[model samples]
Target: MHIAAANREDDLQRLHEQITQTRLAILVTHNEQGLQATHLPVLLDPQQGAKGTLLGHLARANKQWQALAEGAEAMLVFAGADAYVSPGFYPSKLEEPRTVPTWNYVAVHAYGRAEVFHDAERLLDIVSRLSDRHEAGRATPWSVGDAPADYIASMLRAIVGFSLPIERLQGSRKLSQNRSAVDVEGVRAGLANSPDPLDNQLAALMRQP
Candidate 1:
């Protein structure tokens, strides 16, 4: 990602939160065939400090998993929120028509080496963690153990479990950081007033000092 100086997020904790908050991420890889990507919901395991691993599963029929192996490098992208920033929103635009339109968004990039785990027990663990994390916030939480043993096992077989041990982490928070304070406020208000909840949430984030 081409993150401008004003938009860069260098704090590790901030970057980590962005990754953890996002449930879905795009996993990308490069090979002889060129670039390949897969969209998946992921769990970020922060046991290894900055070198955390991303856990997720791929359908057995998915060829993207086939291309990954132990130590295969991959990138995981976590998108926070985005909104269009009109030039009219910029306070400076009232003074002159010099500023161009832009976007306000945040994203985190994780680079890692993958190790595919096929063991039934490991699969069960991964699935359980994913389930628990997602259900933690729900009023009626569910669990992997709630279903029949055989049925859960059968379901697990239809997919493959893997972990990407992170090697590099980068983040960008382009929330009109390059704009003047007045323009920033304008963008925030524009996003906050949007119909999309995500845009509203993003605006709130941008409003943070």
Candidate 2:
């Protein structure tokens, strides 16, 4: 991603926080055939490596994993809040009459070398962690052990686990940072008042430094 200096996000903790908040990531890889993507619920192990490690799985039937055999690098994309920015939102636009509409959004990209672990024990551990991460927010959390042992084993066998130790992390928070203070406030107010929840989210992001 080509991130402008004003929109670049360099804080590691902030980037990881966004990763944790995102529900799913689009994992991208290049195979001998071509580029492929899979939407996956990935776990971030912040302490696992120099950067961090990603834990996720794909169904055994998924051919996307076959690309790993050729040692392909992987990229996981996490999308955040986004909204439409109307030129009318900027008071300066009224005077200049040259401004155009644009989209304001936030996204993170993680690059790494992926390793597949298509075994029972490792798969069990990965799935258990993933389950715990999601369940922690519930009033009554679920666990991998809640299911029948045989059933859990069968499910694990049907999926293949993988780990990507993130080598590089990039974050883009393209709010209206390039605009004037008055114009930025105008954009924020417009988005904050929008009926769309996502627009409110994008507006909320504008309040942060």
Candidate 3:
């Protein structure tokens, strides 16, 4: 991602927060055929590597995993709240009429070497952890052990696990920080009143100090 200096998010903690908040990520890779992308929920292991490690799984039938080579690099994109910014929302637009529409969003890109594995034990552990992470907040949290032993084994056999040891992390948070104070306030007011919940969420983010 081409992030301007003003929009660049350099805080490692903030980047990690964004990744954890948005568990789903777009994993992209290239092969002889062409580029391919898969959306999956990724778990971060902050203690696993210098930066961090990402764990996720893909269906055994997915051709994307077949393209992975040892030490090959892949990118995982995690997106947070995003909304459209209208030119009318900028106070300067009424003064000079030079303002244009833009988008406000938060995103993080993680680059790492891809490693594919099919170990049943490792795959089961990955699945169990993933399940626990997502199900923790539920009133009736279901677990991998809730299913029959043979059923769980059958399910695990149909998927493959992978890990990506993060080598680089880049983040961008474009929330109208480049605009004038008046324009920023104008945007916040306009988005806050918008009917879309996502717009309201972005407005809240914009108001943060």
Candidate 4:
């Protein structure tokens, strides 16, 4: 993305946090036919490679997976809290009336060559890790072992696993940093009292220095 220097995020820890907190990612790839995208929950292995690696799966019937050639380039987009910033939220809007509405959001873009695997054992491991991560907060956590072996094997057979060793990572956090202090505060105050949960979340993020 075209992230201004003021809004660019280069901290590795912060980028990893954003990716993990926003578990779902939009995986984009292109081929002879055209471009394709899939929304999937990705697990990041921070120690896997020079930057990191992303793991996820798709249904065996998903044409997107079949469309990917060996060592194909892919991009994963992870989005965090975002909200509309109204021109009225700027304190100078009433006096100058030059401001226009814009969107405030946090996002990370990861580029890598995707490697697809269909081995049952690898698929089981991926499924197990994903289950543990998502179910840890539940009152009764479920595990791959909780199901019958045959059933688990059958389910694994219906999906394919893929890993992308990240070659490049870029992040952007546009949180009204370019605005004047008064305008930033105005945005925070306006979003803080809004009824939308996402707006309130964005307000909290904007408060972070």
Tens digit of lDDT per residue, candidate 3, span 1-209? 99988899988888888899997899998877588899999899988888889999999888788766544578999999999999999878866987789999999999987789999999999999999999998999999999999999999889988988999999999999899999999999999999999999899989776
Computed on alpha carbons, the lDDT of every model, listed in order, comes to 0.85, 0.92, 0.90, 0.91
Candidate 1 clash pair list: none
Model 3 steric clash pairs = none
Name the better of 1 and 3 by TM-score: 3
lDDT of 1 by residue, 89-164 (tens): 8878878888887878899999877888778888888889889988998888999999999999899898898878
User: What ranges in model 3 sit over 4 Å off?
Assistant: none
True lDDT of residue 13, candidate 3: 82
Looking at model 4, the pairs that clash are none
Residue 156 in model 3: shift from native, Å? 1.0
In lDDT terms, which candidate is top? Answer: 2
The TM-score between candidate 3 and the true structure equals 0.95
